[model samples]
Target: MLPALAAMVFTALLPNLDQWRRHELPVLPAAADGSVTFAGARVTLVELSPAQLTTYGDQPFELPHGVMAWRAVLRLESADPTLNDYCEIALEDAAGRVYETGADEISRARTDFATCKADASPAPGASPTASASPTASASPGAAPSPTSGPDAASGSRVYETVAYFATPVGTEAVAVRLHFPSDAYHDYRLTPQG
Candidate 1:
């Protein structure tokens, strides 16, 4: 009976070996540490601030009454910034509810970060777009537009994006989930408020 069961298991797995090998897993940041790696880039949650503190773009992000907003500061570090892949970022609540940035007001916001994914082949002179990492701009006193990473002295550079979320006046986000280039996997990082 044991031999038959083993054989059956092997048979079931054999057909899906490729899927098993390609199976993806979540890369979660350590509880004690704030930085995690996603798509070969070191990602760090620099800060999470209340909406009152968020000043994205030239105008402050506006939301309807009874809706509150949470601002997330994401720091992406990579030697080759162009190699950074697109990242699908979402805010997760304790109830397992996820707020997708693409399907809401967040999408309409004018953010410094590039929202489009990279094109494999571009027009003659078009440059490859990196959704997760965009060239940082020099904006004085910018909240999150473009702060160079702490390791500027090294060859590496850091790019930052201010991710904004609108929730019920009293609601807050507990964690953030980021999936890049490939939807098969994600990096789960707990927020300071989590």
Candidate 2:
């Protein structure tokens, strides 16, 4: 009877062991101390000091600058919701100004992560046509247009429309703040705002 009872307990705990392994698994690359990358930077989690400061190396805290993109996992340090959980944060520039980007300015591209598996290719189809219509120009140094009417759609356009593109110009700094729907999981990519 004792051996039968032990088997029942092991069977009940087998499913839970699988779930627990999935959550606390180390999936991504861990950053080492004093390591740097152009894409982003990472800091190791350490114990809080007596003055309520998290320190690493010679500095009291690690502050990353000029980061184009980054991924960070912020753990709950204390009971203070405002300061303890660093998940939902606001971005402010060096001049005490709030950094903001309007949603309307964002591109309308969709990701196929849900539908497509790892070893799948996108469905092929005919590309869309970009109609290049003729327009009149009145600038002094501008070249005069040869055509005066709307140009017909040719075989294909020189370039295709994209969600985002890079330019020579860029902002001095940018700030990303996570807000709304508290403690939600979201996957997003950041493009250079022009």
Candidate 3:
């Protein structure tokens, strides 16, 4: 009976051992205009920007002293035809300070970060001559455009969002961290261009 119990315990621990081995892998790194594949989804960090203020619709939002708003533009593509929901985005400075993506009013507003849509083709039966409307400029000290995320269409899409950080006024040398939801084993880091 003692041998049988030991065998069963070892069998149960096998999966955990596999998980531990997976965690031993090194963290992945990327940069602006670089891409990485995680859990079968292809993710690319297109652009990163530091801003003083942002606009939500017509409302202007500003950060307090020693704080700034950082934006990241991501392009995701997957053959599975579903959005990649198992991911977290954050920003980290050289001093190891981490800042999470904000959900405040200004962050919630869709401001335009640089986004390149995968499918530029118009809908079937739609006129090719149709054009987008002109947008009015935001007031001084506000972001110039509205923010938007990926459309609900299947396949590939572009995602743009902002993360706010409370760092010293002249803080540079920051990098974006993309955490996988599946396991804490690995994270992707993307350093922005100066």
Top-scoring candidate (lDDT): 1
lDDT of 1 at 125: 35
Off by over 4 Å in 1: 1-32, 53-62, 102-153
Please give the lDDT score for candidate 3.
0.50
- lDDT by residue (1-194, candidate 3, tens digit) is 99999999999999667445443545577734466666655666555667545466556666665555666655555544133445666666778655555434345444432211222322234343332111221211111112124532354333333334445566663677777757667767776543
Per-residue lDDT tens digits of candidate 1, residues 50-74? 6552234556656666766666666
Candidate 1, run of 10 with poorest lDDT: 138-147
Q: How would the candidate models be sorted by TM-score, starting from the highest?
A: 1, 3, 2
Which of 1 and 3 is the better model by TM-score?
A: 1
Scored by lDDT, model 2 comes in at 0.23
How close to the true structure is residue 61 of candidate 3, measured as C-alpha lDDT? 67
* Stretch of 10 with least lDDT, candidate 2: 111-120
Which of the two, 2 or 3, has more lDDT? 3
Residue-wise lDDT of candidate 2 within 1-194, one digit each (tens)? 99999999989998667435433433232223321111121112111111111232333332234222111211111111122111222222334332222112221212011100011111123122222211111211111112222321222111101111111123232322222223243311121222
Candidate 1, position 114, lDDT: 30
